[model samples]
Target: MASVQHPFPPLLSQDSADIERWLLALNDVYASDEVALIRKACEFAAPLYHDEVDVTGASLLQHALGSASILIGLHMDHETIAATALHAVPNHLQDWREVLTTRFGANVTRLVAGISDMERLRHFSELREAAIADKQEAAQQVEGLRKMLLAMVEDIRVVLIKLAERTQTLRNLSSASPDTQQHIAQETRSIFGPLANRLGVWQLKWELEDLSLRYLEPLLYKKVAKLLDERRVDREKYIADIVAQLQSALAAQGIKGEVNGRPKHIHSIINKMKRKQMEFSELYDIRAVRVQVKDVENCYAALSVVHELWPAIHSEFDDYIANPKPNGYQSLHTAVLGPRDLAVEVQIRTPQMHHDSELGVAAHWRYKENKQSESGFDEKIAWLRQILAWKAELADSGEMKEQFKNELLQDRVYVFTPQGKVIDLPKGATPVDFAYVVHTDLGHRTRGAKLDGSIAPLNTKLQTGQRVEILTAKQGGPSRDWLSPKLGFLQSARSRAKVRHWFSEQNVDDSIAQGRALLDRELVRVGVTDINQEKLAQKLKFNKLDDLLASLGRGEITPRRVSLAIGQEAPVNAPRASTQTIATSDGNVVIEGVGNLVSRTAKCCSPTKGDEIIGYVTRDRGITIHRRDCPFMQRVPEEREDRLLEARWVAKTN
Candidate 1:
């Protein structure tokens, strides 16, 4: 056979190289009339292949083609890719419409225009704030736009492909500046990543998380990467040896099984360290091995073989073959001493179980992963998709990707209840959290708990497979003690809010009653009786007298304080002083002997001249006349009460 060779040019000299490649690939599938369209599309995409502008990077063509591969893998068509490449075509320095229309006909032009409008969104802050303030409106807008795009062209392939192109451009622009990287990653994490994850596009979701994590927490990302990289060779070797030993042991026991291994991701290892407060050296279960076999009989046979080969750790042995997690995770897990006495964990399951283990959450997402399994979780998982969808789409949107990333990166522990029901929680979940998960009533009344038939505190952190039994009382409710900053937050937001709600309702009632009494006393001090005050308050536009009373009752105003308040506002000519002298009532004043000043009363106090009088001689001013009974005169008393003379006021000023 003769070999045919095609000539290719280096990127340095290849003019229209990308367009040429696209046409060649398109030529394979299309007929003559369609081939004419492919040539036209090449002419349209030609400018993007230029050496200096869009073609600045040698990798540009590869990135665009790679993005196209992702779209095609996701089930997109040529029309979609054609629209997508046009979508990324920049028109910042030129009239974008004329350029787009001049190249591809209006179909590609219109789709690109819609994406361009969304990207050209002005006042990013205001739009973000509005979305936050009115989530329903924002949700409506999201669905509306999505529907519009779908309705405009019944081909969703085009928009997805365009979005994929945008994602690639973002990845390219990331290296330009840290700020650019951060902005692009934030957009992807907030918007694109969640959208992709919801649609079950895990390949895109994972790349987006890693890229976002790289820029968002660069140090953390690098630390994790470095830690993983450092341990990579040893980890690979350890798991490989463990798997090899397990398979050999199983084969010798006449049990056929397939063995494989997986190492924990860096994020998961870091999380376990943070959660359990352990040094990196103390991490257990960092590497795990799986033995997949024929049936439940072989599964146990493999387990027995594993146990015989290595000394089994009784405490770490998990018999999920008998009881599986609620999420349908089923397997026989056991930790044992492998070659050289190294601690190695082994999991035994059937081929069906092996598939379930890999496709845990995807059992419901893509229907293909939903095969019949020993664990009955696939049915329950379908129900969770709606709940998880909101979590991905709405509730705290910017954190959606981070939360998803963390959930993936964090470790899980499976626990159990007295009745053999399985409960899966985060590694450090406590009994109170479990109590809440059981029932709201039980959570509120939970005073203590019993773990594995032994008494434990409500805050006791549950270990995997430990049976929890909560102790409650008829009269008891949640203690303030349960809301511990140290123990852990009961992760159920409903549970936490219910506990707070009980305390808040009590405080509100107490404050209202206490405020009323304090304010009522204030109004009584003033001679404006409660009845008269009602009339005054009505004139003041209070809906009812209690409103005025309550306002006063609340210490917001005082009756004595009101006197000073009213007096300060009155005119100078008004009778500002009260008619009666406002002092402790008694006619007799305590004063000493001084008759001359008592005979002619002092004008200052309006004291009667003949009234009980006393003389208070002033500095360099003699014999200021006053009634002895006057309060100020009485304040500085003289020798005899009998000699204290009275003074009467003479109308001097008038």
Candidate 2:
């Protein structure tokens, strides 16, 4: 494990001074509680760990204990922190067992053992002993095994510890191997961040993004950080002025709320830069003051006062209050020029809403704490689920960017249904998406729409604060043309899946009809046509004849090959024996091969009146028509001579 080429550099290696400082801070806070855990975690990890401070597991263990203390609401003893240090190593299972037994006895060892996932199994792999025939397959196997091992563990603490360790590894890895650093950063951006996001850990979510950005896009990260640093003086001044003016204005209206100013994070700044395609100077919302009032009404009252105090930027107002976002985010936002001509952003919301917005649901969870927990945080996770539904397809784009932008991008519009139901959609979402948001069936059946009480087409783009009315019909459904790429909203995976499902059902019906008609034509061509065709299907090893026809219709079954297998003679003018079945208004026509077959114009080559022709009988499908000397037709059914059916086509019936 200590070899130079080992996968992950030992956790405790390097950055000794930083680790010592952080440990000292934790000790100052928790005293013996932190000190005891720190020593025990190091000692337990000692046998597997390297003596050099760089390879020690103490730092990762300490961070794990710190995070678990917050998450599980537990003051960790030596045993818990020791367990954290070893969570990444299954090689030292005996050491962990002994430590658990000495500190917290049998129960802790069981907990520790439950999380041992054989991460070191590669050392024993027989496949490794043999030359790995395919490197691509081996990497997939490694990831598959890792996921399986993690899923097997019941205690979430193992997962939490591993999460911290991975983050630390990713952070250190960037400087060690730029390629692996970037690759692992992307993996974290994709899998770990989403897991943290799903778990409602907004703090971890932000850290994942922030750390990944730092590694994968270092220049951009540095630029954003430098820009923030340069503007720190201006930012503090801007928000302070906004707070003064807002408080005075609220006092004028006899309204009171808690107003605090906070700066946007560095990653958020970089995102604004990339999405807006603007320099740092162009972004106005560097420092925004937030207002958390006692109730929803006061939130709006405070907003009105703030607007009255500073001349509002007319086009830069968002009223998420009356029309909350689909994710249940409700806030009033406005940018205004404050004292000294500084542009300041103001956000007003209820206190509870402010908490939910920041933690996004992590603020409240009814976990196994003795104390009663909260509920709305769990509901906020429901918002994450909705976002995930939209995001799943982006995984393949090989870019975490769209997720970053979509999660952080601020431009939005709030509209209302005619019944006063608020709909929060992206700025450019058309009435079609609005209809789907109302109900998918409404989207499928939408006839026309009314925007601001005026008739409009279904493609009408919604504006903030406008009233929308959807006109639907029982006789209508989505147009096939709506699936065109130009219809932006319907192009989303959810909408595409629904529309595709509908059309697939339609195709099934069409295929069934086509299959039946082809069966009818082929059976009628034979002398015993009126007899039970079901028994013929059984004779051909088909449970249902329709399946055989469909196979013929879809080109899965070659009629000429079927004929040759059953010893039927092929037609002279029938289309050349091939898999492709040509469709017609009369329905699909194919060769039936289970019984004696006949000669007809081959559907594949559709022989003209005076042209030389030949016919071939198929074992499964009906007779196939072909040109007289076509090489493909002559090639099928090389041996069977007695199964041939005689057939001739008369002059056109019409």
Best by TM-score: 2
Residue-wise C-alpha lDDT for candidate 1, range 74-169, written one tens digit per residue = 434445456555555655326767777776667667766765544433122224424445767545434323322222332233445545654455
Candidate 1 global CA lDDT score: 0.53
How many backbone clashes are present in model 2? 46
RMSD of each: 27.4, 21.5
> TM-scores of all models?
0.39, 0.46
Give the per-residue Cα lDDT of candidate 2 at 468. Answer: 81
Local accuracy by lDDT, each model = 0.53, 0.54
lDDT of 2 by residue, 286-390 (tens): 767888788988987787787767778877788887866443556888888767666677888888777655444444533232444345534443344334222
